[model samples]
Target: MGVICYTSGTTGAKPKGAMGSQKYLVVAGEIWCAVDNWSPEDDYLSYLSPAWATEWVLGLSSGLRSGTTLCFPEKPETVQSDIREIGPKVVFYSARMWESLNSTIHAKIADTLAPFRLMFNSSLKIGYRVIDARFQKKPVPLSWRALYKLADRLVFRYVRDRIGLSNIKWAYTAGASISPDILRFFHAIGVNLKQIYGLTEALMNAVHRDGDIKPESCGVALPGNEFRISENGELLVKPPACFSGYYKDPEATKKQFDKDGWIKTGDAAHITPDNHLVVLGRMKELIDLGDGNKFSPEFIETRLRFSPYIKDVMTFGEAVRPFVCAIVVIDYENVGKWAEDNRLNYTTFADLSQKPEVSKLILKEVERINSVLPDWSKIRRYVLMHKEFDPDEAELTRTRKLRRAFMVKKYKDLIDGIYSDAGEVMVEAAVTYRDGRKGVFKTAIKIRDVGGA
Candidate 1:
């Protein structure tokens, strides 16, 4: 019997189902097993939602092909300890989850005592140099390599165990672009973090191999997959494992393919000389200012999200506006820790975000990001959002991608204040609980200027 799978519906639109034949599933499973070098003795974790194609294929179908043992956590909260216990041979996580774990680790590390903190930072520095050399395809210097070995024994090994990545022979992150900093950090700590580029329709297109890892690119295309860039810079793929079509949606199915048989991926990308694919955000999401300058909000957001305190960011710019602005969602746990250490009392996310000290802390992060960006692309102003964007409220997709247009419409008033001369603005917003109850939240959201810009 043929199988049907519904996408996560992360395109700020309605969900659609794709149909796949049994033959296709078998071929895909075999291909995945071969590419990852999966063996019968391998242990795998099934943690992500099975409704997601990546999880279903890799955790179920692929495991079936290799006769691998699979484990599932008791609950989502127990996943970390469960992972430590099982020590899976192969692991996959979406970029968001990896970033969240990165933030949590750094937040906790910052709380450590002086001697321990010094040792951790010093070891990481040595590890970075070794990994950097390896990424450049150059030999690691004898001294640094020796130092790294000692550091690994003393620091990185423990760090990896704590993070439940000590035994991960192959660690893959996909679904969305990951911060390069996060990838580098994992690599520095001796984790073989790799990026995968693929879609629900195509299953997988590329993955970073062991020796040829590139943190910036999503790695080279998989075997039996031909990828090319369109005239408008959209990534197109022809993978053997591609779905037949969108189930009961002919128009949508037809729109996915170009004049030729290649599937239009709707993502903008460029291939490096080494054949690694560097995805440059979605084509339709590019922002252009009136001054003949254009930038990818996703690019900027990725960099801003590297900050330990920034849980989420939604950047905005238009042909009419002179510069860009952002709505930032602070990492509650990390920021709350800061508040506690400073003896700042706060009852809620809304209250913490409105505090002048909190605004100042976020401004410093914005300035750090601004220092590396072009003048036109720098965020001149920003407001810490009172609440995190929720999928239930239609502010984000189920996969946690920002619905830019929807968010713009929902927070038009706040965007206006960002461009206005006002230093702060009071606003009332309605929040929806998971139970479907609604309540009004009112707060004076401060708009902070970056570097007097």
Candidate 2:
């Protein structure tokens, strides 16, 4: 069967479902099982966006080939408790999703359950070490790693027991880059979370392996897949599992493949001396400053997001532009901690974000990161969000990828406010919670002047 299915385009505009052949689907499953080294005893959690191809094959076909029980939670809220209930041998977690999981579990039951053998996440924000640093430290009296395992045994093991993953042997983060904090935390807690590199078009480009986990590298290319770095630092592939062609869309299909059957990926990636792949960002997302300095918006955002106060960001500039600017959302939990510890008084997220003292604090953090970046890559101006983005509202996809077009439209007024001469701008918005409840709220957007990078 051949039918056109849309792609989940995260850049430029809404995704257009492209046509794909059933052979493409069937072959993907065949390639992944062999390359991922799927075993009969392996079990998995299908939590990724199935609308996407690679995840769809891995969740359905590969799971079947591996002869593992596939588990799906009844509801989003049931995910954590269900994982403990099912204890699937492997997992696929997104960076933001895992961060939310880390936030909820840490805020609620971190010390209780923190250990499992074969846990894998698909999206990683930073490394696991970065995650552990976010919380208060507890003194332990065992193998440093074992103690974290015990925390999981105490708290997360019930989750494993409940989910039937009491014996997770390996874990992986696919699709997108995950935060360093989440990666480090899971590994610190006993999940052997590693990075896997590939895209929907080309299924198993590389497996990064169990013992070969690197800090940010996406691992090396798999055996039959051809990989190379272009002069512009882009990644080009010729995988055996690569698609025959985009179904029926010869124009789009021709745009991707080159002579001799090479598929040119639009993503920017580089190889470490060790030959591991370190993904830079989407080819289209690079911010080229007028001064001729180019930087990845994602890289900048990842570093900025590490700050407890900054939650969301959109950095834009062209090579010929004078400066860079962004719209940022505040991270309330860490920011609130800063306020309480310092005895700063604030009644709400809005108040804390707008406070001059808070702005100064964030400014210093921004500057600290900017100092490490090239001059053109620095953030020049920014505005703070009164609240976090909600997924159910469609600002973020089910897997938590920012719908840039959706966000740009939704926050058009606040974004414009960043450029206004007025010292502060107030915006009226419709907000929703995870529970699907909705409400209208008005909040002032605070703009801060950031010195150049």
Candidate 3:
């Protein structure tokens, strides 16, 4: 019998049961063990949901094959503390989890004593300089190397210990595309964070190998896996541990594979000259502008999320539209600290998010991201969402991927206001409380146009 793992349904489509045989699962685990150099000596934290295929292949199956020690937190809320207590050697986190951790670290640093903050910032600057030199294949000066070691001992090590990642040996991030800036930040702090590219149907396909890491790419294909791009730009892969088909959905399963039997990954991707895989976004999720310009919303959104003040972003444009617009969700903790530091008082999330200072803060972040984007893909206008995108609200999937279609329909008024000359729009939103009670509230959300646009 095959094991069934349901898809996360990030596109707001019905979840499909992806079935993989026992042999396939074992082979997948063995492949990961070989690539990751897993051994009985390693300690792993089991935090990812078992319902996800990644957990099955990376945690349970691989742990069984490698005889690695597995640790679990007492509760979801205690994961950070538990990680510190256990000090696992191997760690895997989703993109959102990594981003949140980065935000938390920055917020904590901002609140620290000035002397310590200055030391930390100076240390990070040196680290970034070394990392930049290494990425560019330039030799680092001996003096810089000496300074980096001193900084690591004085600052980076402490930061790592506080975040419960001081002992981490193999840090992997997946589930969604992460900001390259975040990856670079971790590496600057002496963490060997690598990106993985895979899907439920294939278990695991590509992963960064030691010493060949690239923040912008998801590394080369794993051993016994092959990747190719189709005529329409969809990524096609043939992995050794491929799932059989979707359970009880033969028609849908049939569409997943091409006539030649390679699985159609439904993602737009390309291989670099050096064999690095760069996943752009979902094939259907690309935004086409009126002037025939096309860009991936994810491409822009992931970069924008690198800002500590922004939590979530959804970029919108279509063939009928001349320019792009966005809906931004601010990081309440970081932004709140910034507010208090500036002597701005706020009561609720809505009140804080709609503040004039907060709008300007987010606008600056948007412009920073726009600086790197193509002219046609630059965000012309944006609004700070009164509330965060909650998974309970179906704005995001369980894995934290945006449900774009659902969001577009749900926030039609906000999008309309963004496209128009409206200075602000009034929104009445329904929310689900922790006690399972439903409630509604109204707020006036302000929209801002980019200065250069």
Single out the weakest 10-residue window by summed lDDT for candidate 3. 429-438
For model 2, the superposed segments whose C-alpha errors exceed 4 Å read 2-5, 18-23, 105-166, 244-248, 306-310, 319-321, 332-352, 355-368, 390-398, 403-422, 431-442, 450-453
Candidate 1 global lDDT:
0.85
Per lDDT, what order, best first? 3, 1, 2
Number of colliding residue pairs in model 1: 0
**Per-residue CA lDDT of candidate 2, range 130-162, in tens?**
334422243333454454454565545554454
| lDDT-better candidate, 2 vs 3 | 3
* TM-score (C-alpha) between model 3 and the true structure: 0.97
Residue-by-residue lDDT tens digits, candidate 3, 1-453: 458899988888988999989987898888898888888999988898889888888888998999988888899899889999998889889999899888989999999999999999999999999987876668999999999999999999999999888888999989899999999999899888999999999989999988788889899998899999999999999998788889999999999999999999889999999999999999989877868789899999998988889899999999977899999999988998999999998867788889998999888898898889888989999899988998998999998899999999999988988888889999986655446777789889998889896
Reference-based TM-score of each model: 0.95, 0.77, 0.97
Positional deviation of residue 64's Cα in model 1 after best superposition, in angstroms: 2.0
How do the residues 175-234 of candidate 1 rate in per-residue lDDT, one tens digit apiece? 889988889988999888899888878888898888898888999988888999999899
- Global lDDT of each model? 0.85, 0.66, 0.90
The number of the candidate with the highest TM-score is: 3
Arrange candidates, best TM-score first: 3, 1, 2
Tell me how candidate 3 scores on lDDT.
0.90
Clash number for candidate 3: 0
Q: lDDT, candidate 3, residue 223?
A: 88
